[model samples]
Target: MKPKTYFLCTVVFLASVAADASLSLAFDKAKLDTFLTTNACKYCDLSEADLSGRELRGADLENAKLGSVKLSGADLSALPMEKRTKRTNLESANLRGADLTNANLANAAASGAYLREADLTGADLSGADLSSANLKDANLTDAKLDGAKLDGAKFCGTVMPDGSKNDEGCAP
Candidate 1:
């Protein structure tokens, strides 16, 4: 092979390796398993996990790293107050770019969660405590947000449930 061709091949190989390594580090398998089995995985790395269609009711995911996670159609709602272990706690969790389309977040305590750019289309967020959550650029089209508490929540460039665009906190 020509010297130039060899060097280019080496660089491409290295770049592919680096990309694979980064993908492997995206999430912890043990942590994802624990969360799936027990519905609780606080303070763990679950970024980029494909948890679609999982029953995650009342999950305790406080401070979890869920960036780019795929939780479409997952249930994140709390049980009846008497039988509940706790509300779905996404407080301070990093859920940026997460795909939560059609997920059930009713009665969840998601205060301070980072949901920027998350797709919440058709999600049931009724009664959720989203106080202080960062929802900039998020899509909530057709989502049911009845009774949801949005005190201090950021809505820059967010798509509202009623099909309206919200730039309430966006910079001019």
Candidate 2:
């Protein structure tokens, strides 16, 4: 092989390696532990963190900031009624494809959050504010939405709490 050609191939390989490195984002376990122990991490920068497929049941994240955080396939279910206190605050967070089965999100503020294809089965969202949030293709089977805000929320192909599908908010 020619020297010039070899140099070109090496440059291309290096560039690809750099791109892959930049694309990889890891979850911050220390930050998660801090939030869990203290029960307070308001405005904490956890953007673009990967927390997929983890069990974070009964986490109290009220008023915490989790913008652009990746929690796909994670279990965020709430604690039992006897051990319940404040609801988790996921306001304006990117929770696309996350699992929140049986989570007690009563009075939680999740306005304008991205929850596309998320599983919220049996979650209690009573009095919660989900206005303008994306719920496209999300499953809400048996989830409680009594007095919950849904004004301007996207529900295209979304499953309702009563096990019915709704496409009222879908755009043609």
Candidate 3:
């Protein structure tokens, strides 16, 4: 191979290796598992990972950074049915079609996130920040949304299941 070609290839390889190393150092499955099992819901960083179609019931991920993560079709119904709550920093995360029935997400920051077709039946979302979120075709039956922020959020074709549109805290 030419010297120039070899040098370019080496640089690319090193850059890829460095990126992988950084990702591995940042997120580890064993540590996440330990935190999940213990329900220690606070300050977990799970950014830019593929968690699509996984079961994460009762996982304490409060304040976790889940930006650019693919959680499409994941089942999040393992949270407490009565006190259903969220503690994660899901800003700009993709959660399309995820089941979050009876989940409590009071004060959760879900701004600019993609939640199209996600199920959030009877969920508590008081004081949650859902600005600029895509909630197309999402189910929010009997969900509580007192004091929630939906500024610039898209709710195209979203169903309430009970046939009631969300008027509480919605800005016109």
Best by lDDT: 1
Off by over 4 Å in 2: 1-25, 42-87
Q: Give the range of the ten consecutive residues with the poorest summed lDDT in model 2.
A: 59-68
What lDDT is reached at residue 130 by model 1?
95
Off by over 4 Å in 3: 1-87, 165-172
Estimate candidate 1's alpha-carbon lDDT, on a 0 to 1 scale: 0.92
Q: What is the C-alpha lDDT of each candidate?
A: 0.92, 0.71, 0.65
Which candidate number would show the highest TM-score if scored against the true structure? 1
Residue pairs with colliding backbones in model 2 are none
Q: On a 0 to 1 TM-score scale, where does candidate 1 land against the true structure? A: 0.88
- Using TM-score as the measure, name the better of candidate 1 and candidate 2: 1
* Total clashes in model 3, counting residue pairs 3 or more apart in sequence or in different chains: 5
In candidate 3, position 64 carries an lDDT of 59
Residue-level lDDT of model 2, residues 84-156, one tens digit each, is 5445556666667666666666676777878888788887788788998899998999988999999989999
lDDT (10s digit) by residue, model 3, range 1-172: 9999999999999999999899764455665566557744355555555565665654545445554444544544334466665444556756566566666666767777777777777776677788988887778887777887989888766776576664433445
